[model samples]
Target: MDTSRREFLKGTAWMGAVAMAAGCMSRQSAAAGGASGAPMHGFRVAPMKRVRVGFIGVGARGTPAVKRIAQIPGCEVTAISDVNPARLDAVQAWMKERGLPAPKEWSRNGDKDAWKGLCDSDVCDVVYSATPRPLHCPINVYAMAHGKHVLQEVPGAFSLDECWETVEAAEKYRRHCMMLENCTYGEEEMLAFNLIKKGKLGEIVQAEVGYQHDQRSLQYNPRDGVFWRIDRHMKHHGNYYPTHGLVPAGRCLDVNRGDRFEYLVSMETKSASFEAFGQANFPADDWRHNAKMVKGDINTCLLHTAQGKTLSLIHNVCTPRPYDRGNLFMGTKGIYRSYPSLLMAWEEKVGDGGAHKYFDEAKAQKIKEEYRHPFWKVAGEIAKKVGGHGGMDFVMDLRWAYCLQNGLPLDTDVYDLATYSSIVELSERSVNARSSAIDFPDYTRGGWKTAQPFTVDEIDMSKFGFTS
Candidate 1:
């Protein structure tokens, strides 16, 4: 091996907690809640007009996100920052081709920290960051400190310390700091959430959610100018990307609403596929072939809620398998599972043998349509047209714009970001301790006791000049 196994294992021991704490200790006090006539805990912009947006990290995710934001009526891409000048130039060229004015560009200018200039600039009302995991907290804190609301990518923080910093920064700035967890807005997932909210699930007992995609090609490819994801896989051994599944699952379970995640334990199978790929793709003598990998091929984490409910979350990226988010909810009266959805319920009907059975396709479709989330029913068409992750991503962007325009609190708040992303750090602690239970932090500061449960409230279309 290029490095001793002990050296590789030693890398995981450092939490960077002290550095994070010292950095946050000097930050200004949390921002006060909104003034009268403003939405709760929201900072309202005067005479709300088109929201000016600044984007950082315009690579694969940010490129498409900027395009989707440009399609929204009340959102304008005002500024962009990227370490890759080619990406910035490409996006500017695309805007010009589409007859939209080019945005101000913030280049790295020999400083790897150039994103800070974009965050500190006055050109944008909302700062959207799609940077790698390590940079999420720093960029967001800087953005909020500069009085800009933030729409950041998923798994917003990599460690508990970073999560705390995010929560404190958002509260202190009194500005919106929403994680862009698009899965929560997926058409089917939103419908499931609506059913859960209406008590159709009849007290969810256990739920299973996962990011089970076999996209090793993306993970192994280093030519795209960013190997951060690959680097994370090399250095960590826990559920790294938890938000895609955890956020929606948490919302359905009403995490941090009526219930909060109490504690979690995780276990993993030995790593194989990544090691095999390195041997086959790289030179035999190359260090890549011998680099020590700590990540498990598949990781399973079980989390219990304060109400005694459980959430089963799995993460698998190295294996060859079909793409599946593993959205499954088992309730007292019924159950729902997706990837071409299937529903079985005691309420639907009984089988000829006098047993509860699966609902017929037609009946199930009718029920889903009936309970279909209002947001999807009203805006699903536009979302499809705008088109990101089968419209869910676009819907998320438009909703962020709508909330900002109307001065309403966001769908996924700062606490949600911290709690869901906490799984990353917490799962690491659990796995390293031989699957010992790790307690979840109550980022809400005891507010979960009375916080309102998740809702499927549609955006106020009229505010965005839409007449749905």
Candidate 2:
């Protein structure tokens, strides 16, 4: 192992020690139901008939999400807010075309902060924000403060402080706040989750997951609200879009429940490709061409879990690589990987050739069918019918609504939002400090020790209306 990896292990060991000490110190207070500053609470609101949703940022992502949420039977898209009037008008027109009533518009003409008023309004029970990275924390905090549940976009917040604040607000206000990490809802991931629960992959030791898409055009395109993404790339130098793969990996590893992320070390490749892409695509006089990106073309982050499991996260959005999340889960008994989507389990399943071979398409299909998750069995077809990112987005929306309507806790709670998103800030700190180990915040306080692992089968789908 290299120095950085050694340092990361040491840092995680230190964090584990601190966590134990903190838990010991707070045992008495926790037993007495003390209001510790730590996020030691859950979101279990009273059961409601329908969940009314107010949308903020109806741009590229929000548009599809809004439409999907509208299709969910027990959810209402009651209000819409956006900085751009044209986008608001477009949403309203689209709703009208769908034979749905135009939602109450909540834009303040040119105010970028108009979403705050919508959050404060009683028009909606939930605030669905697909805003830029910097705005996630503020909007979520405000929404929760005003008694609205939140389903915000991924990498829940931008900075460590933002992560803490988002968690604090959610815990303090007793509202469900989930990061919309739709990738976790993918079919294969769900299958992996079920297999993990079944011990098909015995005692997961390590995994690799991340966003590896070449989003160069989308990043620098001024038309698609890429300016904000570009700005983030220019300012940050770590795993900016970590949640896409991290969330699914965490679910497999049982993060925030059985295994908490302890610490991470990161190193980044030089930022040459994006600069070259910019020069080739944009005009010589354009700032996008001349300006240099601070973020490297690729970032690799290694995280240690409290349970001694490890996670390798890769972030590369500017490169010319084909879209890949690199979802490779390993264990004592088996391994699973995406890209071509294959799995291998103790040579027994591979038919014992005295050498390793991945399961062929037919065998893999059989395995998936045999171990298909209960949640997918119930919701997959409808999700596919509704369609977003191969139905994962729709599945996420459905699950959120189902949980809220049933008064159950979210799968990806505030602690999840904080811990997963913290990689953005922590990895940068690590890379800038010569790949030093950085301690992860225990946003769950000491609750992860006893927190119940979320089982997909435990979800009460009978409470949900799955219209075909």
Which candidate leads in lDDT?
2
TM-score of each: 0.87, 0.89
The segments of candidate 2 whose C-alpha lies over 4 angstroms from its true place after superposition are 1-42, 224-226, 347-355, 458-462, 465-468
Model 1: CA > 4 A from native: 1-47, 108-110, 348-355, 465-468
lDDT of 1 by residue, 247-353 (tens): 88899988888899999999999999888877887887876676667898999999999999999999998888788887889877677776646564544333333
Candidate 1 local distance difference test against the native: 0.78
Q: State in Å the error of residue 138, model 2.
A: 0.5
**RMSD to truth, every model:** 12.1, 12.1
> Residue by residue across 1-468, what tens digits does model 2's lDDT show?
544234322344223322332122123433343453445335577776678899999988898887777756567899999888888987887788767777888874968788888988889999999887788989988998999988889878888778767777776787788999999999888888888888776778999888888888887876755588878889888888899888999989989887899889999999998889888988998887887989989999999999999999999988887888878888876788866556655444434452266777888889889988876776676566556788788778877787777777677788898888888889999999989999887877668888887676544544554332
lDDT of candidate 2 vs native? Answer: 0.79
* Residue 335 C-alpha lDDT in model 1: 77
Q: Which pairs of residues have clashing backbones in candidate 2?
A: none
